[model samples]
Target: MFEKILIANRGEIACRIIRTARRMGIKTVAVFSDADANARHVRLADEAVHIGPAPARDSYLAIENIIAAAKRTDAQAIHPGYGFLSENEAFCRACAEAGIVFIGPPVEAIRAMGSKSEAKKLMEAAGVPLTPGYHGDDQSPERLLKEADAIGYPVLIKAAAGGGGKGMRRVDTREDFLAELASCQREALSAFGDAHVLIERYVVRPRHVEVQVFGDTHGTCVHLFERDCSVQRRHQKVLEEAPAPGLTGKRRGEMGRAALEAARAIKYVGAGTVEFILAPDGAFYFMEMNTRLQVEHPVTEMITGLDLVEWQLRVAAGEPLPLKQDQLAFRGHALEARIYAEDPSKGFLPSIGKLLFLSMPADGAHVRVDAGVDEGDVISPHYDPMIAKLIVWDETREKALSRMRAALADFQIAGVASNIGFLSRLVACGAFAQANLDTALIERESAVLFPPEAPPPDEVFFLAALTQILGEQGVKGCGRHDGWRLNGAFSRAMAFRCGEFENTVEATYLVEIYRFALGKRSVSARGRLTGKMIAAEFDGQHVQAVVVAACGALNIFLDGAAHKLEKLDPLDVAAEGGSGHGGLLAPMPGRIITLLVEPGEKVEKGAPLLILEAMKMEHKLTAPATGAVRAFYCVIDDQVAEGAELIDFEPETI
Candidate 1:
């Protein structure tokens, strides 16, 4: 085995690889950018080296920097954990030339399966079940549109070299085909430097299922069963489970055989995933193969009781295949949730900042977490926003779903927006539980999953009320929320805690408390609690639910598992909710990359005033009307906290 390995990615996957490397008694090296200097992955590795600045082009994607870091750390191998360089054939070849092993599939397999169009042609030649589509090399838009017309109105335009929903678009009609095609090609060009696209029949309500295949240098390949990743949003998998719930025995065998054949067609080595779109008629069509480890690989490991990372290392070290296809036995069901730092209401935009509070669930024999973050870890805009992967295993699918719901409720995070509420409801919904839904489930019912919270202003006022009472009543703000019956009776006391301190307060039912603090004095605050939530005042201004509870917990409830205390209490109470001019500005947690205006600069209504890059995307805060910039408080590249003023404008004269 290699004594030292360099992880060539960031975030959870890099951290995940380092963890397994440690257990195997191998030394691990981590490479990072300026933005990731304080990131979790760097902290956990045995050694770390600065590669470059934040942008992926300058850092994570720079093959020279990665090779240099590996050489400097004396790493015998480079593990391109998922994203950046993991599937780049040239990177793999470079490593081979450098005499450093690349801990993944051989370069030949990467180049063969990297392009969706070529991979489809190769699969057809190899006699694997193929999807009906156009994988030709013609770059002319006119030619591609004609192919789509022949295929039918509904077709999927996917990047020849894309993954993770970046360069994929679905067209429902011929009229929209041209526009969507251009968009897809543009995204593909920017994201992958390849604008080649292919068209495939858009399977209605498609269930994304993939078989995990592993091969060794000794020429043996085996299947670790499959993962059903139908629960998704924006073409990205949100919830994944192994041993597809409704899969027939014959279908499972078919999928396994197809996956192994696909691997053999390319002489694949190391771990890879062969994805397929399962249809309602029990038929499946080939999708592209993931050349590196998958984010959802934990589910496969849970059912098979195998460490895929370990298998990858063993295979790369020239070890023969340890298990045969027949020896692999899948027992029970396993589910995995991709917990992300994103706002479900705001179109799932990535969220970033310090993790003020975090409580991870205990991992027993059957539970596993492939996370690289710690409580104090800062989620920077420099990388993917996934906080962690919480996986559960049980003997039955129903049990796995129930366990997942409960686990999501118990999982806690603060200081930034997240999709915990969105994920919890998704797993518990009848559609998901029934396992009959597909890719369109989220799109057709997008509004259902992220129903608008009551108006933000109303929530804001309610929080202000709670904070006022909390200040006046000490630990007994409960009285403000409790109502007397017509006969004047009935009250209960809730014990509120601030870290190690706890206080009991008297109140009527459903007056949810947010935070209670006892210093020289005590303060308590509550918001209306209802429907599996304790809606509370957060941060003295924003009204939000801090804790989402088990739906059953409503029947026998105390405090909700989600906490709202910290967002509500500022260290300097006097500084809470300072003045704002009523236009959306950076709330409190990012940097202003550029000030697009100056004082006295006239702009049209809703025109861009400044662009803020937070969570790795640029957001333009616009002018409310045709007005002049009366004041400006930020400069280009200013590190402004949330709520920092960027531009203030005066109403335009008629």
Candidate 2:
């Protein structure tokens, strides 16, 4: 076993690797960028080293810096958690040349599976089932268009050297093929520095299932069953589970054997995953093999009761496989939900801000939380906006689903928008509850998952008002004791705003409860505030909630939903920025990649204006109405902050 190791990554995965290393009595070193100087992983590791600036290209992706850090810290091995340099073949070779162990598959395996085109060829030769597509090396646009025509409409153009849903496009018609291909090539070059692409026949109603396979240097390899990652958005997984809800025992065995074959074909060592696309007719085809640990590996761990990271360390140290296929035993069902700091209502845009308050479900035998940020940490735009991974396990799939719903309800976050509410609805939706899952499950159940917005219930406002009033009363020498007049019931008015609408609540102090009136409604309310938690009763009904005051607003969390209400100050006067005369502002902080319409150009309503790239995804800004471009506030490659004007336009008169 290695005495010491360095983790060449950050965030939850880095923290996760450190915990397992500590358990194994192995000292761990952590590498961080400027943005993660005080990150959780840095605080947890035995020793920390500064790598570079905030951008990944200058820091996490700097292989020489990471190699030097490992040597300076005297680390015997380097574990590239899951991203960054985890799958980089050059990094693996660098470790070997530097006399340091790379705790992953060999460079041969990574190279074999590095390119989607090459991986497909290997899988074809290994007798693994493959989907019908074109993986040829011809880069001519004419050749690609010809291939697309032969493959029929609705083909998927994927970057040959990409993962994580980047550099992928699904074209539904021949007319859109060339444009989508150009976009995919641009993204591929930007993300992976490889513009080569392949065309695959788009599979309809497919489920993404992958098998976890491991190997050792002693020529032994085994399987750890499979995980179903069918619930996705934009081809990225949102929820994952172990043992796959509807997979038959016979099919599971077949997949396990196929995965073992794929591993053995490449002489693979350490941890790797063989992903497949399962069609509705029970036929499965090879997608691509991930050369490193998967983000959703925790579900496999919860079911097997084995530390995969520990296994990686043992294998990298030239040890035999811990357990063979027959000895491996797994039970129960596990589910994982990726909690991200993005707003679901606004096209899932990334949200950045300081975490004023953070509360997650307590970890226990049935629940676990793998998080990277603390209460005061900032969710910078320079990295992925993931908040945490919430995993739950139970004896059966039904029970596990129930446990996940409860855990999500217990989560509370403030100062940044999150997908907690969207996840809560997704788990409870009828289609998901019944395990009718596919890649399009999110889009299929959009109605239930994203209901029409409605005004918050009266209880939300009541709770917010109560929390504010009670908090103010606790301040020494600043509270109004006159509300307790003995001669008569004290009366006061409290005003609040929710977006553009405002309301005032009238309160009369009585014996033990307060009578409140809002518009034409009246209710008697009483509540107790216990350190940001509230247990309240109104009109003979009981409710429990959490309230957080930050960013000049009162955030109320109740029953898995969050409501923001700003307290109105009558003596203050301030005007917010409204419509800027047909100007389009940046929705989030990002760099402009392309300007489709130049200044002084007339465009129709809904025409594309420019493309803004943020959080590793491209979003096209469009014209709000029939207008002519008057001026451009930002040029291509300019970094702009949230709400910064991007374009100014003049609308044509109706």
Candidate 3:
């Protein structure tokens, strides 16, 4: 076993590695960029090293810096926790040359499976079922189009070296093929530094099922069962589960055998995942193999009661397999939901900001939370926006689903937008609860998941009002003041902006109760503020809620959803709107990748104006209406901040 190991990644995965390392009595070293100087992983590690600037290219992906950090800390091994440098063959060789163990598969194995196209060819040779497509080394646009046409419409163009949903696009028609191909290539080069791509027949209603396979130095490889990652958006997984629901014992054993074949094919060592796309027709095709640990490995852990990180450490230390195939046993079903700093309503765009308040569900026998950021930490745009992995286990899949929904409801986040509410609705959705899952589940169930915003319940406003009243009275050092007066009860009106309209609620404090009236509706409410928590009642209905006041707004969390209501100041003048009228602002901090329209060019509504690359994904800024481009505020390759004007436009008169 290694006396010490350096984690060559940041955020939750690095923190996760450290916890297991500490338990095993191995000292852990963490490397951080400028953005992660005070990150939780840094605080948790036994030793920390300053790597480089915030940009990943200058820090996390800078292979030399990571190697040097490991050497400086006297780390016997470096664990490339999932993302950066984890599957890079060059990084593996660099570690070898530096005389430091790389806690992953061999360099030869990485080289064999690093590219999707190469991996497909290898899998085909090994008799692993493969989807029909083009994995040839044809780089010409004309060649790719021909291949797409041959493979039929609605084919998937994937970056040969891409993972995590980056550099992938599905083209449904020949008219859109070339344009989509160009966009895909650009993202691939930007993300993976490789412009090569492969074409595949996009499986319809396919369920993403991947097998967790582990190999040791003794050439012993075994499967740890499978996880269903079909609950996804934009080709990225949102929720995952182990012992994929609805798979028969025969199918499970088949997938397990196939996964072992993939591992043994490369003489693979350490932890790796063999992903497959299961068609609705009961057939499965090989997807790409992830050379390192997956983001959703926790579900596998929960089911098998195994620590995958520890397994990786042991394998990297040249230990034999922990257990043979039959000895390995799994008892129950497990589910994991990825909590991200993103807004589902805003097309799931990344939401970056400080975490003003965060309340996670308590970890117990049935639930666990693997998190990297704490309250007050910023979700910088420099890396992936995943907040945490919420995992739950139960005796059966149905119970696990029920547990997950409840756990999601217990989650609370403020400041940055989160997918907690969306996740709650998703797990409770009929299709999901019934296990009718697929890659298009999010789209198919979009109506229920992204329901139009409606006014919050009256109790929410009452709680907010009560919380404020209690706070103000506390400041005045008045305890138990029941608004006793000579003749009348003390009363005041509070105005709050809910959604788009301002609502005023009149409150009168009398005796030990408070009466609230809003328009024709009224309710008597009284509540006590206890450390950001409120135990309140409205019209004889008891309720519990959490209210957080930050960013000039009151965030009320109740019934598994967060509602933001801004308290209106009666004496304050309203600020004028239209500050960026006739302009398209950058939604987040990113670099302009392409200019789709030239200045003075006329375009129709929904026309793509330009592409902004942020958080390792591409966001297209489009024309708000039929308009002529007035000017280009930021050119291609220009780095722009969030809300910076990217283009100036003038809408045409009707």
Query: Could you say which candidate leads in TM-score?
Result: 3
Over 1-654, each residue of candidate 1 has an lDDT whose tens digit, in order, gives 989999999888998898899999999999999988878889999999999998889999999999998988899999998878899999999999999999999888999999999899888887788779899999798999999999996899999999888768899999999878876786677668899999998988788999999988888999899999888776778888998888999999999999988999999999999999999898898998998999999998888888999999999999987789878899999999898988776667777777766667788866777777887777776667899999999999999888887787777777667788788878877788888678877776666676655322223223333433433344364554343355654444333333233334333323344333323323345555443344564345334443322211111112223323222222233545534344446744556755767778888998778766554334567887787887777777688776666667676766
Sort all candidates by TM-score, best to worst: 3, 2, 1
Better of 1 and 2 by lDDT: 2
**Alpha-carbon RMSD, each predicted model:** 9.0, 2.2, 2.0
What is each predicted model's overall lDDT from 0 to 1?
0.77, 0.91, 0.92
- Give the per-residue lDDT of model 3 (tens digit) for 1-654: 899999999999998999999999999999999999999999999999999999999999999999999989899999999988999999999999999999999999999999999999999999999999999997999999999999998999999999988889989899999999999999999899999999999999899999999999897999999999999898899999988989999999999999999989999999999999999988999998999999999999999889999999999999998899999989899999999999898789999999999999999999999999999999999999989999999999999998998999889999999999899999899999999989999999989999988888878878878988888777755555566778989998888987776778899988889899988898888888898889998898899988999988999989888899999876778678653448779999999999998899999999999999998899988898997999998878999999998888888876
Worst 10 residues of 1 by lDDT: 549-558
Q: Candidate 1, TM-score vs. the true structure?
A: 0.77
TM-scores of all models? 0.77, 0.96, 0.96
Q: In model 2, which regions exceed 4 Å deviation?
A: 479-490, 499-502, 569-580, 600-607, 624-629, 649-654
Error of 2 at 444 (Å): 1.5
State how far residue 386 of model 2 sits from its true place (Å). 0.7
